[model samples]
Target: MSGPGDVLDLIRERRAFTRGDVLEITGMSRMTVATRIDALLEAGLIIESGTEKVAAGRPSRRLEFNTGHAFVIAANVDTTHTTVALTDLAGRVAAEERIEVAVADGPDVTLNAIADRAKHLLADGRIGREDVAAIALSIPGPVDPDTDRPSQPPIMPGWDAYPIPDHLKAALDVPVLVSNDADAAALGEQRVAHPGSRALCFIKVSSGIGTGIVLGGKAYRGTDGGAGDIGHVKIAGHGDLLCQCGARGCLAAAASGRAVARALVDLGKPTASASDVGVYLADGDPDAARLTQAAGRVIGEVVATMVSLLNPSEVVLGGVLASPPLLAGVRETLYPRSLPRATRHLSISQSTLGEKATAVGLAAMVVEREYSASAVNAALARS
Candidate 1:
């Protein structure tokens, strides 16, 4: 019975393994291993794959976790849009949709819209409501990691201490988990792109500026889940500038994607949201590219300090400003401003996974939460 968790862990960690391998790794008798495998099979957590030929005796059946056993509902909400997706237990997205909505419209309106989109995505993926294991969400503000609720979010009006899990749970009828957008983005990048990195940092330059840190393959969310809120750090030169957090000369007020968009609009170009800046840059708009790079320079000034403090091996520039201009601006400042020893081996680049990063991270987190040792034990008891 105790071998179930061990067997599952081995299979998940190694991708595929045989019954004999699990027995050997767990040091459990053959009968106990067989019984544990049966229990996992009954719970639909794992499946037996084709047999592997041993060097000597009978062929052993290889076991792997059933990724399609259940579905996870994930949502990545930003200031101007929301992405909803249905993913398998392995964080593979089946179907996804992006809804144009505003985060400033209050959580009730935005969360309800997201719930409707999620239900439709589930149907599109051909997964039933009862098949949902959990729901996960990431927003463009600080979140209390312990409680999965918003925490005094400066830009998100009427969202402080909102019961995000309760609202989504009422609509979706499953456990809901929430985190800050930057944290989820970093975790996704770490899991998929740089799995072996010891220290990684993701700077999210969306409607605002924030950072997410991953140390040793885990998110380093500090006490009260406010570890990476770097947007409010004041800059010396921009004394008269006011930030959305009611602070003067804040980094976000000077260098965020939103700031760039506002600047473009003031320059007689039509720009609505931070995502619009990305669209314009992608279209090779010279003005957009130039201003975006300038903003990146301002952002890089702050990131250089972070590089000195953290000495992360990789720094991923993500969200709407993940472009050549941003990357170049960051490199321009980070290399010259940071300590030579700290940045000798540092690599900085744009986000590869794009908008799907948060959705995938949410699915991976929900799967991990649902299948931990204690959760597995409780599930077996219920079975």
Candidate 2:
């Protein structure tokens, strides 16, 4: 009884399908299936491969969504650098570029540099603006859901309530969706690494600490888009340090990459940022190891409380601080502290996407938003 549009919805939702599979799943007639397939194929929304092996006589051709028909421009903008990538509908980065732009310089300069980098990368990849279906942008700050603007983000001075979406849209001439960097990374991990899991909690420990949560296979942006702003959670008895967010004894204030750097400085070592700390750790510096481990313990305590409450199946540690020793420290504190039921099924692991996770997650957002059943149906109907 389902129509071709309904069948297409199933395919889009599942990301792949075959004619027989569609028929059986949707309970549609053979003629209806043929008509829908013809329409989808003609509309350039789906592609038929050689065949799928069933049993004996012959294999029926398998149909798949065509990724080449469109692409997404994704950017991950941090306080110290920006990484731009062009990805197809399949979430594969076709081209990427990294630029060191100080976000404190002002939004205009930083955003302009990013837009230019994106333009050059797209041209290098031979993908035109029309071929770019959408733009997914990740910023190292909290976003206001209603305004689609950056909130009073820490460290990146002079970018509060900035109209980021409008600026990027004007530059790229495409639809743009913006989100917090940690949230975007969470979505990326969900799409690429753990597609089967329905819920996930991604904790990013970079220049600052943050958390991203995905529920039911979608990023859960809380009211005002600040659900996972765990960086400001207080750590008892650590009241001397000042956080960039103007709070005292906040998690990020005491245990972020910046905090690690400060700890190293206090130990009489010259250090700049967390990346430098990571290099030191990699070079086997004992002091760096000690400071990072301490930071990890603090982060793990927070994560343990989160796990106990959310009961997520997986807890992914990411960003610059998710190093080996840091992970060990988190495990050292979390497993013993969290509720038994919550910690029992929890599989803690480092992020597989690495630094590019947010950029790729941005691309995934574009694909999910622009290539949905209704969008494809509208395109097919127009054609």
Candidate 3:
């Protein structure tokens, strides 16, 4: 055990523990445990919550991770809007807001709006800016792992290689972490909804399609941060279709929300974006349902390959068009095409968190990054 950081992790893992329990589990000297525990208490990372009776003479004071020690700013940026939330260290939302800032408006306008809204939320909640540990952002595109910036996003024009973290950090004056929206949503779902699922996949079918994979309770970003760009996966018999990435026969071109909306528009339903498609689906529009179902089947064809490869415990469909018809279509094609072994333990479902999934995931990312053992240790040393 290094010190308070490890102790904090132990307290957080157990929810409530005593100094004697830490000493017993770590096998550290009584004096050393006292020193570490005192340091954490001083830093406000851990707090005493009443006492627990022991077999011996005296009772032991119970300690727990102090969720109020700091807050996290979680922002999920999509094509049409951004959802900003202030979350506790425990990934619980304390306050949230929605802003109408389109990604197509470019980063400057959108990021500034997000920062302004976040500040408003903090003020409304009576939380100081200094109390914020970090900010986590989820964008509707792939983020470069090395630079922490958007990397050649197709629908997100003018965002390629943009210094997203740097821009947000400058505005917020705190550490900023950027991730793909799908990846964030996957992490959020796994942590909140499917806590037992060690391996899971989240497929986001919006204006574009993306996949987020969680293995061993962590988001699996690929070598270049393009692990789940399934929207661009080439589907047979769609060669005539073109994607926003200037590619032909891409899955998104044929079956994404944009594709469905386009088909709906051709049929004279007057839909333009994924949100519109979602409204129609909710209203039980037959044309919209039919198109969404067909799109789901096409997406399922691609997911079948993923199921075979990853053998995930759960596959969640998220994003704007995640509905009953879509889920049904996916089940129709995915199970029939996937191997029996893969399908035996697989459970496919719609997103439980709905629009809040990305924000929850971003909060998880913030907590994991800001409160990791090393980060906590560094803060303690500095203090």
Candidate 4:
């Protein structure tokens, strides 16, 4: 690891630290630590916040990271809406706005809208466009992380094999990272709500249902990037309803927000979209609650398998329809179906971060990518 990068990491983890603390923890020579500190300060990546009071001798100055040294753009795209935000290096959102655009509009139209909105948000924040260190995007589909491209996304048509990173990089003139929304939500929820969680699963039930897995504080996207894609899991008896993936009896077709909306329409409630269903739920519509509860039970059938397979410590329910019925349905089915050993310590609950989970997750991923030891070293050396 680069000395300056390690020093910066220590400061970030500890929030504030003295040169002596860095030297001791890093086991670096005094001269090495001093040189690293000087390099970081010269690069404007850190600030001398204040001195720590000492009982004896002279007080030592504590170093703190300069979170505003650069900014990152984070975008969270779902089936019916997109959110773009400007965040500091520490992933704290400085400005954010939501755009009501349908993902069915295709990648060209949607990604362009996101890029344009990000520019406007940066303008509103009065941050120079050139100061953007990176951009992170969270989409409602499985992403091939190796290539940062959507891969056979059932809900997101015209996005398959789309070079999202290259497209966004062309528009924003910075490197871009892309991930599935469920994966992003998992990371965001785990970091904020369950920081101590070693095995966590975030379930998103919107136009589609997906799961994000995290273990040991890091994402566990299986090889080829389709690990937690529980949406396509087939149900034994429900072969009547067709899924967006061109398959029958898929969990999404039976249990997603769209599924319940379709159910509501069957009962003459006639919701055009999941967002409309959310409105019905907000207004305490009993039919919506009942269908949602049934949807949850269907999803719970799939989640039971996941709990047994991964034995996650936490199962977070999120998305537009993460309401009472869904939460209750998941808990009701998950508790009884899952093995006793797996359910012993598992905590299933609705997401506390709600709609902001994707944005928070995207920002965190960007920060981690931009502030890795090698990335920091490379950045300072170029500077």
Model number with the top lDDT: 3
lDDT of each: 0.85, 0.82, 0.89, 0.85
TM-score of each: 0.91, 0.93, 0.92, 0.91
lDDT of 3: 0.89
lDDT per residue as tens, model 4, 176-288: 99988899889989878998899999998888889999988788888878889999999977899899889899988888888888989999887998888889999999999
Lowest lDDT sum, 10 consecutive residues, model 4, at 7-16
The TM-score leader among the candidates is 2
lDDT of 1 by residue, 261-326 (tens): 999999999998888998999999999899889888888888999899999999999988889998
Which residue pairs collide, candidate 1? none
Report the Cα lDDT for residue 85, model 4: 83
Off by over 4 Å in 3: 13-21, 48-63, 123-125
Write candidate 2's Cα lDDT for 204-223 as tens digits.
99889988998888888888
Per-candidate clashes come to 0, 0, 0, 0
Candidate 3 — worst ten consecutive residues by lDDT sum?
7-16
Q: Indicate the residue-level lDDT of 346 in model 4.
A: 91
After superposing candidate 1, which stretches have Cα over 4 Å from the reference? 1-3, 50-62, 122-126
